[model samples]
Target: MSVQEWSADAATEIVRAHSGVRGALLPVLHALQERFGHLGPEATRLVAKELNLSRADVHGVVTFYSDFRTAPPGRTVIAVCRGEACQSCGSRELERHAQHSLGIGFGETTADGSVTLDQVFCLGNCALSPAVQIDGRLVGRVDADLFDRLVSDAAAR
Candidate 1:
């Protein structure tokens, strides 16, 4: 669903669905985000009230986790690995090329709403350093040419 279609009632239902469990905060947040694509202020407040926790508590958790998004994602998410292994293999240059090629930095989406660039600590492809993940699929041993082709393919999608 679109961000414009998110409702408090739906958010509340999600909270109620997970309220009977132990340590419901993370699950509830994940549920809300799954349903709405992102957790907005309304859902955060509702979750806080339902769980009897401060809004700050909920907000803090959301902000602290890179997986949680306060806004909607683009059509495709490209996560470039920035781990020690990847960095040692020219991931820094890859990152700079991505920023320049996409006109957006890590954690930001392109203006046309086709791609969102993110930085991941690792993708378990240390052997194939300088890895990148496109739409949840891992691509390793990436260079500038490969990165450009991936970005182009994602934008086309």
Candidate 2:
């Protein structure tokens, strides 16, 4: 979606409110991402202009942060943790299963656009290894069948 379609009032308010704060780029970008799903090129330009920074500077910040999304995410996000703890518990195998099942690899959406897959380092639930997050909810000990069920449930949502 075009950034012009975003809430200009909200964007203005966000920039105005945080313009004076040091290191405000991340928070501002996060707020915009939360509101609009991702930070498109237009939004980045607007932000840079409002903050008296260069577009390259804005792009640099966005690219530097993994949490900052540059495109719209699908309705459901299927993220699998790739950290050592999760990998030890078979996250790599699960990843392959998910990719094959969804017909998409990391940072991609399915053909029907029902879900977007991503690779995360850690879900912060190491004890519950082989972690998978469906729409922000942490799931653990996920096998192929179980992961398939989780994907189906998330798509249903």
Candidate 3:
């Protein structure tokens, strides 16, 4: 997870690269998020201006997509599955443990900026219910201890 600091110049370049293209908003947003780890107000403003759209319009899209982040993420992002299958498999307990241990709820980063907790609907691993995606790698049948170990390993990286 190599995230660059957000800068107006860098954002403008990214927005311009996707300007005038069909359905450029998504690509522009992805590029910006990829570079900065998240899209801030300034990035949204530039994107809206360049795309000839209202700031509200851009904001709506950002909010509508779970993949987009409005704030910087921690060095390691931990995503737990919240789909029906996962829930039925004791994922709810797992999620509670995570939140309690991290002292933060979903969509928030730890105070130390080492871990971020998130929830995804599914990871296509229903067979192994209670799946978790840590730093983009999917792990199935996750429990509290496994999650802690994974998070610890991720932080050490």
Candidate 4:
């Protein structure tokens, strides 16, 4: 996608203004993600060029940080906690159920672009293990049916 398509003039201006600062990766990346919801290839290349850094450098940072996204987000973010606590509480099973119900694997957006499924190491909700978060709101004791219900609700909204 083109930068013009995703970024507002304000977002682009932010990128340009900070591109030349030393150790600017984290800040610039945060601003870009805040503006566009995610960082695409075009944005990375633009940032690299503006900052006098290699595209690989930009890409590396993005990939290294799971918080950075290379594609646009869906209307709702469905994050499954993969932390040890959640894992012990059947988080993996819940993850599979969510993926199947959504028809999209982890780190992928639904075809309708309504939801994005992601994996998180922890959500600090271990007591409610096997938890799911939609738009940052935690839902505990997630099962296949519950997962379906959440997706359906998000679609309706």
Candidate 5:
């Protein structure tokens, strides 16, 4: 089935599944994103109506959390750590190299939808300083070369 059809059906099922729980908004949003890869307008509207919230309220919740995506992500996600520790260890240079190589800034996906670049404050690997998470696997001490390799590996996958 197409993503749109799946999104509509999944949104309805998720709203119904979580409607009875207290503070169901977050869970419902997470479920929708999990099933559909993102929360578009249709899912947001459905959640708002089911939970007695305004579209703005639902949209606010979705936007407030960095984990949520309003649109589908690329085939791979690259999250770079931007914490002070990582910054001190040359994360800035790595970030620049990544942007140049991918031709997209943070929070943007490649035109071909192969990769998405994202920034995270920390990956809890400060000891390694320049840390990056590619598809949820943490790699530390990432230099420009390492970053390139990681991106290449993700694309290959």
Candidate 6:
């Protein structure tokens, strides 16, 4: 998803729009991240104030949700499925190739900012083991060469 820079005015607008909802915190956080690519400190603080919650309260929620990111992600995110099906089909090797070649572990973006490598439990494509998701595009039967090519494609873009 495309994201705009964090603006207090813009964040305030987003926050205020959702503050009235029941259990508004999650929705508010999602909207903020959708706009800014992350829930940075200033935005978090703004939300805490608008929701009449403590910064610690908001921060705990942010950090607790795996879906929320506190910092900007790389342009492309590559997720390898390590589900039982995937693991039985050489996903371990594929996972190693991703980590070694990318030189970053799960949840870390490449130094060049072209990609972020992540390990997920499953993509639910067990029929085709060793599944991968590149920027939300599901791919099956991936190998080291294919992974490299995909990364190159993302970098070229």
Task: Assess the local accuracy of residue 63 in candidate 2 as a C-alpha lDDT between 0 and 100.
Answer: 92
Q: Candidate 6 deviates by what RMSD? A: 1.4
Q: How many clashing pairs per prediction, in order?
A: 0, 0, 0, 0, 0, 0
- Whole-model Cα lDDT of every candidate shown, in order: 0.90, 0.86, 0.91, 0.83, 0.88, 0.91
Candidate 1 regions with alpha-carbon error over 4 angstroms: 1-4
* Tens-digit lDDT string for candidate 1 (43-113): 78889899999999999999999999999889889999999999999999999999999999999998888
Q: Clashing residue pairs in candidate 6, if any? A: none
RMSD of 2: 2.6
Model 2, residue pairs in steric clash: none
TM-score of each prediction: 0.90, 0.92, 0.92, 0.80, 0.91, 0.93
TM-score of 2: 0.92
Q: Candidate 2, which ten residues in sequence have the lowest lDDT sum?
A: 1-10
- In candidate 2, position 80 carries an lDDT of 88
* Ranking 2 against 4 by lDDT, winner: 2
Per-residue lDDT of candidate 2, residues 46-157 (tens digit) = 8999988999999999999887888888788889899999988888898899899899999998777688999999999899889989887999888999998987787776
Between prediction 1 and prediction 3, the one with superior TM-score is 3
Ranking of candidates on TM-score, top first:
6, 3, 2, 5, 1, 4
- Model 5: which residue pairs collide? none
Error of 3 at 74 (Å): 1.3
User: Between 3 and 6, whose TM-score is larger?
Assistant: 6
lDDT winner between candidates 1 and 3: 3
Per-residue C-alpha lDDT of model 3 across residues 4-83, encoded as one tens digit per residue:
88788978888888767899999889988989999889888988998889999999999999999998889899999999
lDDT string for model 5 (30-55, tens) is 77777788888888888888888999
Could you tell me the TM-score of candidate 5?
A: 0.91
Candidate 6 lDDT for residue 110: 84
Q: What is the lDDT of residue 120 in candidate 5?
A: 95
